[model samples]
Target: MARDGSVLGMIEATEFLDIPTTTLADLLGREQVMDIGIRPLWGPVPRIAGPAFTVRCPPGDNLMLHAAIHRAEPGSVVVVESGDLDYALAGGNVCAVAQRRGIAGFVADGLIRDLAEVRDLRFPVYARGIIPIPGTKAAVAPLGEPVRCGGVTVAPGDIVVADEEGVVTVPAAHRTDTLTAARTKLAKEATETLDDWEAAHRSRIDEILARGGFRG
Candidate 1:
């Protein structure tokens, strides 16, 4: 946990956010990503939310991510970019290392493999999809640069909230504001909005609330 009593890892943060990122995404009017694969052995794809730290890696390369790992800060999630390359930006070994480093999780615009291990370790990871074939087999990327993931522009130190609903970036400069706004939005949701909508328009709301339900 953080010195302030805030939980530092993915699991701890979940209780504070109350709702998972996927659920939050739905609440925020985002679409469900059916394509985001899962680790069959690990059950459902885990959802995680926390402050973010973004990284840009060359397509088919993760050397920069390795470098980023060395520089990672606790309570931070490393968001990487691969232009939807469907490449293996990260997997078991890398995630294992990241866990040891005290990082929260990982978000990638590309692809990943080694399904069971990542989840078994309980380290959250978000990505466009997965592929067992791995990546293009190259390495020439730079670290701490801007990256485009899931149709969003991201930079280093940006905040990232990810879940079954998909991945969303919280720009670095707006980190504090974003967290505050999201928390307020969530607070209002739990108290009144989430249930009201479910009661008001049972039919229409049900369709929109298809996956699970959005509080706000």
Candidate 2:
């Protein structure tokens, strides 16, 4: 039997500072990062940041995703655990409805169909693969509960950040502190341009590499 959890209500969009996934990955550093294999299916170099509305579908069935989209608040990202690679849980039509509902985007551990239309619709979607095969809407699964997605645990209200790099999850409890740390790190980096700094430190880098047994 599948289980569902209570929706925690949506985290305010303003709650998410505009921090890039790359910066978040460097700061929190753990399974907080999803596997690199999950790539954007379409949209421009997207930067999606929103509270997670997690849906765990039984393998090959995505009925609960419909519920999740209707139940999710505006600016929420529906994170679905489709549990396999063969079936597409949602595609362009679903995405269009989601977009109208103010969904920030979608992140799925399974597949999605209608690539050209999905891209044409300009919805930001990230998933493991694409297939013409559609998912059946017969399984009863959990929505708003903690679920494993793309190798990380995602809970309702957890902040989801996805970009060209990949998706990263920041636990709801740690988002404020993580955002603060990421901002500080970004501030410091703004002063340290790397282009010439690396060149200037080439000799120092060579010395360290030599000690590590790298022969040039």
Candidate 3:
């Protein structure tokens, strides 16, 4: 979902650092959560939260993603819609530059190279996997535009929260409401004791099972 420039800037300033993607996942619909294939390349990757700076890279060409690292603002998650995974979209130096520039991390639907260097830098990267071969830097695509990555349509400035669990994108238009709801959920969960949770869980499961007429 798109928002006005003024609101987009405001939303970008709001970070979900303490809120896990799991919490957001619960609050957001299934469509907002990325598929399992898009996972952290290296862990324990610290949770990253920021607005997305979207990019689209044509198959076998990564010029746009390379261009994005330089253009994206600090604390922005560079989300990419890679055309294919046969060639890597980025390498160690590219990740290094992005890290040096204070970019939050990368979420790519394709692949990347230089795992060792990225792991050493502790730069969070959630992608399909790694490849030895790198793609050419020839394709030109718009930066900061809406792109499809990991089965989710990510618009520029959408809030991206990612960690070991997974990646979830909160729409820019719903950022305020989602953040409020997530915080409320977390706070309530914190107050609930494990015993209380177990009791409630047991009761809920038993009710469902009874309705299903389970004999066991």
Prediction-by-prediction clash tally: 1, 0, 0
lDDT of each: 0.61, 0.81, 0.89
The Cα RMSD of model 3 versus the native structure comes to 2.3
What would you estimate as the lDDT of candidate 3? Answer: 0.89
Kindly list the per-residue Cα lDDT of model 1 for residues 1-216, writing each as its tens digit: 133432343333444344555444544333222234321224365555555566776666666676676767666778776664556777788888888988877877667778778878877777656667555434665655676666666665555666555565545455455456667777776788756867777977777877576765
Clashing pairs in 2: none
lDDT of 2 by residue, 105-165 (tens): 8999888899888888888889987999887888886567898898999988888989888
TM-score of 1: 0.67
Q: How many pairs in model 3 have backbone atoms within 3 A of each other, for residues 3 or more apart or on separate chains, i.e. clashes?
A: 0
Query: Model 1: clashing residue pairs?
Result: 22-165
Q: For all the candidates, what are their Cα RMSDs to the real structure?
A: 7.5, 3.9, 2.3
Among the numbered candidates, top TM-score falls to 3
Error of 3 at 163 (Å): 0.2
Runs in model 1 deviating more than 4 A are 1-16, 19-47, 84-86, 134-140, 193-216
Cα lDDT of model 3 by residue, 1-216, tens digit? 234563455445455888988899988979999999999999889998888899999889989999989988777899999848799999999999999998989999999999999999999999999999999987776677799999999998888999999999998889888888988999999999999999999999999999999867
